[model samples]
Target: MARDDDTLVQLLTPDGERVDRAVGPDGVEYSVDLTDAEYRGFYRDLVTVRRLDAEATALQRQGELGIWASLLGQEAAQVGSGRALRPQDMVFPTYREHGVLYCRGIDPIMPLSLFRGVDQGAWDPIETRCGMYTIVIGAQTLHATGYAMGIAMDGKVGGDDGEAAIAYFGDGATSQGDVNEAFIWSAVYTAPVVFFCQNNQYAISEPIERQTRVPLYQRAAGFGFPGVRVDGNDVLASYAVTRHALDHARSGQGPTLIEAYTYRMGAHTTSDDPSRYRPPAEAEAWRSRDPIARLAAFLGRQQIADETFFAEVDEQARTEAVRLRERVLTMPDPAPDSIFDNVYPHGSPLVDGERERFNAYRKSFEGSAH
Candidate 1:
């Protein structure tokens, strides 16, 4: 993959140099005008997010979690776009968006419960402005489109206070019927939504090239919306491009598709063995463009953060990781009968009878050691 492709918007180079200006193929000039403090904050977020992912991976290896989908190399893509979202905006995310959930004020421990098989993530979507993690590939796109259409119907767009929706999916999901159907509906209704695709170059074991011949962003043209591809490892570029697209949506310009070109530096999940399908050389090559390292380099070069500051941030991240692990260890398992707790707003006779039978079945093994 050519990192310097003309169509890919990049504001920060892998060498830690800043591109003063970058114009996307869509004719939009993208740049970040963040304060020195904000730049340092972005660095902190990148480091902390990466540390959290590492901790989760370690936990999965230790059997504390059933599985984990890491955002190892995609920290910049998630943090940048996540911070770009307004408080009024809503987000629908696939299972891998732990970084986004962090940005949404969700406790890092919330997702662990889901993976641990104790409970569905119990956070309130309305309160957090983020939906639950959707495990069904591209299905969340359709949900986001429907919610965005509702926003338009409620006359909640086209103003500074207007709301927008963002749906995050992966490159492989573009091939799904639900994703394509979402494009059709959002475009026809001019729904206030942005489709954010982290094109990590693979949909599990399958390379992206196997799914589509053309660039993923180009598909937006067919749906009558603008699409922009950003250097996902460049936090500045990701933030600028996402901010623009989200603003366009809130202003009632309809939907935009943002393809964050990045790489999955880790396995699809703790259960996957990327070594079987991915070339080691490819992973090594991408290591040079690591999102966290690039941002750290930029911070050091610009004097935005000193060695002491970096040390303090690192310590903080380590402390948080330890605390999260402790929390996960102490999480009590829900009662087996709790699964039937939320089946309906009003309990049904059929479900009541089923629960009774289930309890009886459990009592059958009360004193058995088998």
Candidate 2:
């Protein structure tokens, strides 16, 4: 229900002006406090993440990657929210949250293992505080809720150092049973988890209108929790809203649903063509509100970053892209038997038996000369 005058919480306008948001009945303006260095750092991360996405797409086209999920227009949404999490907090992401993975301190090329027909994901969740990308639509929501329950059992909520969890999903997943169940479970337990939906306007070929009758954020009200929508294209808005929600979670508050109103600027994946479903004018309209460009506009207009700083960031992003490309190109192939190695924490006879059969099958081919 986007009327001409929408009420999506926005701090940085599409034209790069920083607008104020009132907090309570007192009319106090809610804002994010960041030093010049922090602002520059946010811009740097946005550039780096965008470069990473562009390079990954190009790599897929050049046959270095089997498929790439491009996070083109949603850089600000990912970067802003990702940075809002504390190191102690954990993250469960849908496959498209590559920018969040980057913010979580995982090596940018770790996802290459999955997309390149290698391992599912090659990093340790405990080490990175970021779970592997879940390919099944809304499945990660359930996993995140269960994990949050464990956090509650461990008594890790209600303090400055308390931990929280975040589940990242798209608009399409909102229609799934798993997502609804997650909502129920989290609400019942008052689990300290934030449901972050990057409503990029499309779930593959289907549009948002096909998913829900009302705004996505409003669905949380049915589950007995608070919900808010923020301008996904505005980095400052995304950051402020996420930081507040996460802070609330850590302070013993229940789940909060944040619907980031953004757009998917590219195809669903390397295999899909958005041109058939999405109109050119629709994509063009969002492009004028591009996240990265708007944040840069704010910086330039306020003199927060000089041309030299942007130039330096551009060079740094290129270096980062090159590093990821080189690493991905030379990534070693995993052993065929490695698949069964991590299938179980405790050994399972069924899995071992299957692995033995698979090994024998490969050995049968090794001795053939014909």
Query: Largest lDDT belongs to which candidate?
Result: 1
- Please provide, for model 2 over 1-370, each residue's C-alpha lDDT reduced to its tens digit, 9 standing for 90 to 100: 2431255777888888888673421122347888989988889999999998899999999998899999999998999999999999999999999999999888888887789978888889998999989999999999999998888889999877898999999999999999999999999998999999999999999999887888888888899988888888888888888888888778778788989999999999999999999999999998999988898999999999989999999999999999989988898988999889978899899999999999999998985895
Minimal lDDT window, size 10, model 2: 21-30
| Residue 243 lDDT, candidate 2, scale 0-100 | 89
Q: Write the per-residue lDDT of candidate 1 for residues 1-370, one digit (tens) a residue.
A: 5533989999999989999989997899988889999998998888888898899899999999999999999999999999999999999999999989988889998998899988888889999999999999899999999999999999999878999999999999999999999999999999999999999988999998799988899899999999999999999999999999999999999999999999999999999999999999999999999988898888999998889999999999999999999999999989998888889889989889999999999999999996
How well does candidate 1 match the true structure in TM-score terms? 0.98
TM-score of 2: 0.95
Model 2 segments beyond 4 Å from truth?
Answer: 22-29, 367-370
Error of 1 at 182 (Å): 0.3
In order, what lDDT does every prediction score? 0.93, 0.88
Top-scoring candidate (TM-score) = 1
